[model samples]
Target: MVTAAIGLEFVKQFLNLNNPPEFVFACCRDPATATDLKEIVKSNSSVIIVELDVTKQESVEKAKSHVASIVGTKGLNLLINNSGLINSQRIGDVTREDMLKCYEVNAIGPLMVAQAFLPLLRQAAGQQSSEPMSCSKAAIINISSGVASITENSSGGMYPSRASKAALNMITSNLSLDLKTDGILCTAINPGWVKTEMGGPNALITTEESVEGIMSVLEKLKGEEDSGRFYHGVKGQTIPW
Candidate 1:
């Protein structure tokens, strides 16, 4: 539901462009169960919905296959690693299992997705035959959080989410260096206090506004030189490590 809402808003604005970009919305659950998302797929024939479980390697591979079969060797121009989960637990109350689960989903998942989809991204960078390829740039956007920066609150609890996001930031920095030669820009983006299922009711921003600001930032991303840095939403600011 969260994925559908965010994707719908982003795609609605994205399709409004003078030249709309091709898009795909991937999820772990069956598409048949997501009627609202299915409506999006129906309304936008250009948008493809695929089943993807970022936490599972097999699921990621299956998603890659589905994408390859649909888009072919040309590759994807942009990859948004927006899949994440948050658990509210205090430090003394934290459990080992939950900590591992948080790391798997928040940190390792994006890394797996990046590794799995890199060939296609590299292909997108190399292909000169198409419009997306004509741009000659591929980017990976890792959605992160503010808690990753200040761990004061984390010391008492919520260690998993905070620590994992920090690790994700590190992964983005490292990937920016590793993929620079391939012309794949990898960066972490803090979406701010958006009111989603995870962000709760009192959050400062709505998902629509947050995504709008994020898309704006993404549309302006140029090349590998912009990789590895941390960007805050539509305010056009950078977050310190």
Candidate 2:
């Protein structure tokens, strides 16, 4: 799976894996300021750092160019949309600016990234021509949330995060339909309440646990019909939409 440096958990998992030869491109906005991310780079030679700002078209196009150069004939097997924005604001207390900004990053950013990298995904599918005619194709894993679930909103607060994630789900569903013809698989995953900056210290899962579960999901999931499905990060269980 191609995981971005939204959190180093996925990166850490990829680095430690003793599996088949799958390239991991750690795309982010600024590698220079990413001290923790840079430190991870010191240990691994396969990880390629490409500058990407998913919120901006120009930055994504530039990043696509850089990744394309690196991935010449091979193309990309997976594109992981892990970058997210969370604005903790109550419904009445939320500012207009924060609401829009949340949607821009959480919802729209993934769309832009997927659009920019589609050709590369197609290339990867073509490269695997000898494989069986299965739905196990090029994939895009979107790090979505349980908060976005309209069926499970018991507390009903986090307006910005909830709304933006819901929008992201819509994008994922449409993307699956739109890209399936090209043998591209697209799906959304809720990483659960992990102890990250956004998930906070009291959360149930650790980054390691979350990443482990996510990796399993990417490895085992199958079929084009499975694309656009919302998966709970724990053991790739199907979540109710």
Runs in model 1 lying further than 4 Å from the true structure? 1-4, 128-136, 150-156
After the best TM-score superposition of candidate 2, give how far the Cα of residue 25 lies from its true spot, in angstroms: 1.0
Give a tens-digit lDDT track for model 2, residues 1-241.
2434335777777777787335567876887887777787787767777788878899889988888888897788788888788777897899888889989989998889888888898898887665522323577788999998888888988899999999999899999898777778888999988887777789998888888888888777766767889999876788876
lDDT for residue 235 in candidate 1, whole number 0-100: 83
Per-residue lDDT of 134-194 in model 1, one digit per residue for the tens? 1236778888887777533435457888889889999999988997777777888888887
**Clashing residue pairs found in predicted model 2:** none
> TM-score of each candidate?
0.90, 0.92
Residue 177, model 2: Cα distance from true site in angstroms: 0.6
Which residue pairs come into collision in candidate 1?
Answer: 27-52, 90-157, 91-156, 91-157
